[model samples]
Target: MAWGRIQTADGRTLSGMLTDTGLQPMTGFGSTTPAGPVEALDGATLLAPCQPGKFIGLWNNYHAAAEKNGLAIPAAPLWFLKPDTSVVGHGATVTLPPQAGRVIFEGELGVVIGTPCRNASLAEAEAAIFGYTCINDLTSLDILNADPAFAQWSRAKGFDGFGVIGPSIATGLDWRDLTIRTLVNGRERQSYPASDMIFSPAEIVQHLSQDMTLMPGDVIAVGTSLGVRPVKAGDVVAVEIDGIGSAEVTLA
Candidate 1:
């Protein structure tokens, strides 16, 4: 089933299952209790599928991108955190910071946590996973490489509205067979297979869980592959996954 958060006309955000007919409100995320009547999709506004307490992003997780850039396969997942304020829902506008030069869009798969986990085994970590969603990990390239002394990874990617995710989180997906594609202003820029990942989702969760506890609604961006490029103002960026729906954000 596909899960999402929708904002009704009354300004209440509800967790629900996205159905062909509309949204069936749930008591909570992964909740068995039904909340209220179905809200038609057209009448409500979609929010980021989930509000992740921790927004973790991986780097150099794809074999193809590593090979192309002559980057060594990391012994572990190289990760960074984006502040919660960076998150924006699909159809939201991503305003570029005035001093932030040359921003780029990275399309990646997002792993949504369902249960709290710490030092979890692979099976436990897998079970803790709620579903997967599409993420556009927008980065300010100029700010990132501005000072070679220290890589400002978080600052570069943690700007307001930089973390764009959702249309919905899809459960029961065969992630291995999925592909991630990114488009800029209607033109394809990135296309890669999830099979190219150096560290699978389960491994990432299990390993990261050993270091920090992952709570429900935490998101782990599996990272991007080749063909990442810059985007300017007015460009509409879309991240599409085969099973998960597309998430689009317009640059302003």
Candidate 2:
């Protein structure tokens, strides 16, 4: 089943299970049964699939990107946090901040946690996963490397509306068979297979759980492959995963 949030015609925000024709309002978070009438998705506004408390994006997690960038493979995942305020759902218009130089879009697969866990084992981590979604981890490249002493990972990527995810959270998604793609203004810019990841989704969760408590809706972006370029003010950037869906944002 696919889950998503939306703003109804009445201006109320609700969570629901998404069907091809419409949305069935969920009983509550994580529930499978419907509690209200089916809603016509076209008349409602879609939101980020879930309200994530933390957004962690990985780096060097893809073998293809690692090799292309001439970076050595690391034993553990390298990640950075994007503030919750930066997150936006599909169809959002993202404003480019002043002095935010050369922003690029990263198309990735996102793992959404379903259960709270700390130091979870592989099996536990696998079980804790709720669903998967696509993520667009936009970064301000020039600002990231500008400082000599420290890398501005957060600032470079944590600008408002930079952490884009969701059209819906797809349950039972097979990472091995998935493909991620990014488009800028309707033209495909990046495309890669999910099979290229050095760390599987479950392994990433297990490792991350060892360091911090992961709660339901917390997102771990599995990282991106090559083919990233700067996005301009008028561009419409979109990240799409074969099994999940697209998270699109218009830059302004």
Candidate 3:
């Protein structure tokens, strides 16, 4: 099953499951809008699949990317946080903030936490996952790598619409065999199998939980590969994961 949040024609936002039939309202859903009846997929504007309480991101998680840069995999998952407000849906135009400077897209696979977990064991981590989704993880490269004192990755990554997540969460899929590909204006840039990850999702959760609490709806973006490139106004980026659907966005 796939799940998404959308704004209806009536100007209300809802969380629903996309069935073979249509969108069905989810109970007790908390989002930018109130719950409502089922609607056609064509009747609503799809938003990011998650309203993350905490958006955790990984660095050097992909073996290929790490090797390409001549960096070694750390002893554990290296993590950072992106604020929830940065999330934008697929197909939405990403406006470049003058202060942010030039931004680049880091297409990645996102893991959605299904249940609250603190210090979860490796064996239990899989059960805690809700599903997987696609994330662009746009970054302001200028501010990020330029700072001499600090990398400022957090600030460089949390600008509004800097985190692109969508079109829906893919549930019950075999992630290990999945392939992640990134395309810029229809030109393939990055392609890698999930097997190339230095750390698996379960291992990542187990490691992260040892230090912090992971709440339901929290997101973890498994790091992207080495083929990341800059995108400008009018450019379209598409991230395609084998089982999880593609997420596309346009830079404006």
Identify the candidate with maximal lDDT. 1
Instruction: Give per-residue CA lDDT, model 2, range 1-252, as digits (tens).
Output: 899988888998888898886888988767877788988887888999888998999999999889989999989999899999998999999999988979999999999998997999999999999989989999999899999899999999999999998989999878899999999989999999999899999999999999999998899998889998998899999998876878999999
The TM-score values for the models, in the order shown, are: 0.98, 0.96, 0.94
Report RMSD (Å) for each prediction in the order shown. 0.8, 1.2, 2.6
Task: Score candidate 2 by TM-score against the native.
Answer: 0.96
RMSD of 3: 2.6
- Residue pairs in collision within model 1: none
Clashes of each: 0, 0, 0
Question: Model 2 off-target regions past 4 Å?
Answer: none
Clashing pairs in 3: none
For model 1, how many clashes?
0
List the candidate numbers ranked by lDDT, top first: 1, 2, 3
lDDT of 3 by residue, 36-151 (tens): 56677776788898799999889899888888799987999988899988989988888888888888889899999988888888888888888999988999999997879889
Best by TM-score: 1
Q: Cα deviation in Å at residue 251, candidate 2?
A: 0.6
Q: Model 1 over residues 107-226: C-alpha lDDT tens digits? A: 999999999999999999999999999999999999999999999999999999999989899999978999999999899999999999999999999999999999989999999999
